[model samples]
Target: MHRKTIVDVGTDHGLLAIGLALTGKFQKVIGVDVSQQALENGALSLLSQIESRRKGIDPQKAALDVPVEFRHGDGLKALEEGEADIVCMAGMGVSTLLQILEQDHDALTSDLNRRQYTDLILQPTNSKPRNLMFLYKSLQDSGWELRNERIVKLSSRWYVTSHFTRPQSNIPVTALIEDGAMKIPGSTLDCTLSDSDPMRQDLEEYCRHHSQWIRKDSEYGRMDLLEEVWLERFGNDR
Candidate 1:
């Protein structure tokens, strides 16, 4: 796989950065944290490991360089525009994450156009399904599309990671559906869909059948209320 520039926002310990660097998955890796102590500790921990690795190499041998750096800052403020090809914001609350995006919207927009950022990885701290819906709509309005999503079930919570990209002229219809909606081709309700994988056809059929009950009792007034709430919260900026 081709190496890409990667930035991890709210990186508490910098383990992700270290792992990516050591694995050579990223040409450059940056770990950003708001806490100075956390940045220092993470940097020290990574440096110690690098030093340990160097000891095993011959004095005359050139060591494999580690491609990572640690920085202390609020969100992407410390990063230069167009610096990273993949931006990751993990282990943060939905509102906090939204605030970060709102604060750096202009910079991010410029970078997205200039560098053509291929991926945005978001891992929310809590299972806020409504927040996720809000985020999805926000991204869509901002000219971005959800590329992929995964819900990892842990002992206590589900870690939801969503990957997004700038929207293109023609997106596959299968990718336009939201979760828990009808998946039928001619259905009124949209289900979580994707065109990249053909094997998901059965899943689409299942969603179509499952959403029949919801469509029967669904209230248009309730949906309007939800839309109003989202608008009040997110505003026209999204």
Candidate 2:
């Protein structure tokens, strides 16, 4: 979450990567997309942005300090383990998001796991609840930790965004909340949203709306698994 190198996966037009580079928040920004044309366009856009900032300047050679690259590949295949401090996936389908995260295991070299520094920032464009549930379950199962979640409404549609990091046993989930420290039986995890989390109201509404969809056979029932998961991850009795 702090200053670090960034890998923008599923990058469309590379706008976000470019923007971050312009802000100088990251030391490097690598934009990855499945489409070659998209990467080309993004590169051009990045160049144009730089040129616009300094007229009659060579954007590529300009002393912007931050290095930017565009790569063509599916999911995280374009990146090596520990190559990035933060991996961002935005405006992607739930299935694709899941697939990308699943593929991430391939990049977990020993050094990367040891540092536990790589972070994931995901924004799914569809299947919000299902995606949240999948992500929650996946994190718990894979020993990754959910650091934050928020809902954002744009153009009358809401998108759920989450941040995660490789598991750290030191930060118990119960430590995040003021009075919600009911211990999970099998794990020592605790999680809570900030009072100013953008979608706090919407999240509560979602948990209430999906209350009807709880199926007995479902792993987490009809409730938003995000809520069920906090308990499941750090609450369940072993």
Candidate 3:
């Protein structure tokens, strides 16, 4: 746990922000959403959780005193530069996430470059391979390196969660981007993944489950990522 301020983008219920606040890992947590209704609902839920979690404790040292704030706005537009140390956007489709990044590139890139916000956590709610790859490429091209990535199963569903950082962090690479699909130079997807790469297996599994979207779609990059990963991991070589 680190002493940092985290802004949870698209925080529908504010559960993640609240849970993190309870851990004492973060000093403050701000939840931002476009829908005022979601923010109100999340605020009510936070109040309920605070009331239930704070019995027999001094009002000054409550368990839920994590300084969680809720703001209504569209994505990063809700905050000023250097306002937060980290930004977490969960439960969004890759396409939707990409759109937000595209629209918020000015703010996002500025904060990341200034090292005001070091970590960006993106978890696409859906399992669309092409959209994920496109997002990966877009971020890489924009200078954010994928520092950590995980594929986890939750209640019979598998999702990919990625942690990106500016190159200033100097962290060793855990996820390798090899193998070209749409020519995003300097991308994690620029070369072929080696057997030692950790993401190989997860990419294979993701591709296997996403076979249903094999149909062509040019705007979305079609099945290029899916087929490439399939061929690289489970294809003729295997």
Cα-based TM-score, every candidate: 0.66, 0.68, 0.72
Compose the digit string of candidate 1's lDDT tens values, residues 1-238. Answer: 7778988888878887777777877888888888999877776576666756676674542334777788888877777877888878888887888778767556434535665566788887854434555666556545565666654445645565778776553333324443322112112112344555442443344333324422433444334333333333333221
Instruction: Give one digit per residue, the lDDT tens place, for model 2 in 1-238.
Output: 6668888887778778777787877879888888988777776577566756665455455645546777899866777766778878888886777677666555333333643447878787873445555555555444566666666556756676777776554333334333443232112211365446655555554444443343332554455535454434423222
Report, for every candidate in turn, its global Cα lDDT versus the true structure.
Answer: 0.61, 0.61, 0.65
Q: Which regions of candidate 1 are displaced past 4 Å? A: 57-64, 105-116, 169-238
True lDDT of residue 13, candidate 1: 82
Which wins on TM-score, candidate 1 or candidate 3? 3
Name the lDDT value of residue 113 in candidate 3.
Answer: 61
Tell me the lDDT of model 1 at 79: 77
Model 2 alpha-carbon miss at residue 180, Å: 11
Q: Which of the two, 2 or 3, has more lDDT? A: 3
Clashes per model (N, Cα, C within 3 A): 2, 7, 4
User: Least lDDT summed over 10 consecutive residues: which range in candidate 3?
Assistant: 181-190
Alpha-carbon error at 136 in model 3, in Å? 0.8
Q: Give the TM-score of candidate 3.
A: 0.72
